[model samples]
Target: MATQAVTNPVPVADLRRRPGRSASLRRIARKKPVGAIAAVICLLLILIAISADLLAPQGANQIDPLKNPRLLSPSLSHPFGTDNLFRDVFTRIVIGSRISLGVGFTAVFIGTVIGASLGIVSGYFRGKTDLVVSRAMEVVLGFPPLVLAIFILAIFNTSKGYSFRSFLLLSFAIGVIIAPTTARIVRGSALSIRNLQYVEAAESIGNTSFGIMRRHVLPNVVAPIIVIASIQIGNAILAEAALSFLGLGISDAYHPSWGTMLQEGRPVWLEAWWMSVIPGTAIAFAVLSFNLFGDALRDVLDPRLRQSS
Candidate 1:
């Protein structure tokens, strides 16, 4: 008796077509208005920060003390108006963006680097190292970021001379404070990615743990970490400003920081509203943009959200 001939099923390209089409549709659906506005705002702020030197009308800290009278409203000469000391508010705001952006980006960079490293190690190892790092992160998370910043600034001011030390201290403190969140995010992402089939395949092929993590796991986890860090940059900027406004941040009173401006303007708010108003708006918009852009990024990057759409 002749055996019945067996045949494999034909591969259909159409099977791949729907998913691709659906994915495209989903991408379109995930576009949110808030996210778009946020991204634009964030981009605008970044541009402003980058071009601050060129954009600013004069030296950030320069005080005419005579040319423009105090409390002058917005005008062709001074768009944001002059402060109590006849300092150009527009110039100060332009220059202040540099400081805010600098602190925010620096802090986020430090936090993300430190957090991602610790998180990757902790998640991959899942032993004493993880326990220690997790516990330490928890402890750090317990304190209010502002309070911790104040303590750190106080210590630094007392011990080290204040010029760059204050700026460094503020960035370091903010980085440390924000690190726990990044660590947690990275750890979660690593944990999920660690058990994927590719990871198992790499292990089966005799790839070292470190090699597998570095090559395969880290790349996948880094995307979310990057997005988080981007969002966190704005928060860090705001935090630094708050600390400065509270007199616990950058010690240079002469520097043209939005926070410093706010602090200086507090007493003269009624007299010189422009001093605080312009800087305050700048801070608000910068923070808002980062947050909104981050949200948009999340929508754009999230596979689940994309799938739903």
Candidate 2:
């Protein structure tokens, strides 16, 4: 008779507790220059957007019709110089941040709410409902957002009551344009989460469909949606600017928007470079900050990226 050595098996739980190479990669990514710079720029832009009134030297729309000189070049007194209307370029740029941030966040919020709800429902209760919803989303996504917006604006401008209604319409149209993309992203996330063991366990415990989704699914799927929403904020801001540039957004002449400033400055870009340059630069910086911040956030939050990094 021979004595055999017995060995204990490593528990699966214990095996899973060890940090892998991916964790080290994430630590490296957090220290990267791009990530650090992006974070700083994004933070600065957010602060400016929040405190525009306090930071702006003058009223955004105030015109110094008597003392203000058209095509005035940049100087110590007027850092960015005055526009054709003698409005302070610096002040308008600061105030424009409020409009850009407001439109971007509002539009993205509306799109995400509508899209996430539809996607969760469609993905969870798939079949005919999913097919129909998917088809509708595709159709909406097929149209060019800018062209669609132009058409909608033209129609609204010709309507009997063409007033403040235009602003609401523009916001809704921008939201609708972005909704399909959000829906697709949410649907993919929900589909993957729906088949997980925890979800199955909830189902076995007689949890209602809605309850299971609310309690187990939404919380798990929200991270990606949030990243997407943040990224979309920049896109919405750009879209609003494009619409206003073409004279389709915010019809009020007194309203001081970066896009409207660009429109006013375009004709005089060569002669009065500051007119377009200041506002254009503002738009560019704002959009770039949002994008960079979103990228960093996505890398930080994504499980695969986090693991690999």
Give each model's whole-structure lDDT. Answer: 0.80, 0.80
lDDT of 2 by residue, 75-183 (tens): 8888888887787888887777766677777789888988998888878878897899899998887889888767766776654222456556777778888888899
The local distance difference test score of model 2 is: 0.80
TM-score for candidate 2, residues paired by index: 0.84
Predictions: Cα RMSD each: 5.4, 5.3
Off by over 4 Å in 2: 1-32, 65-67, 154-168, 251-253
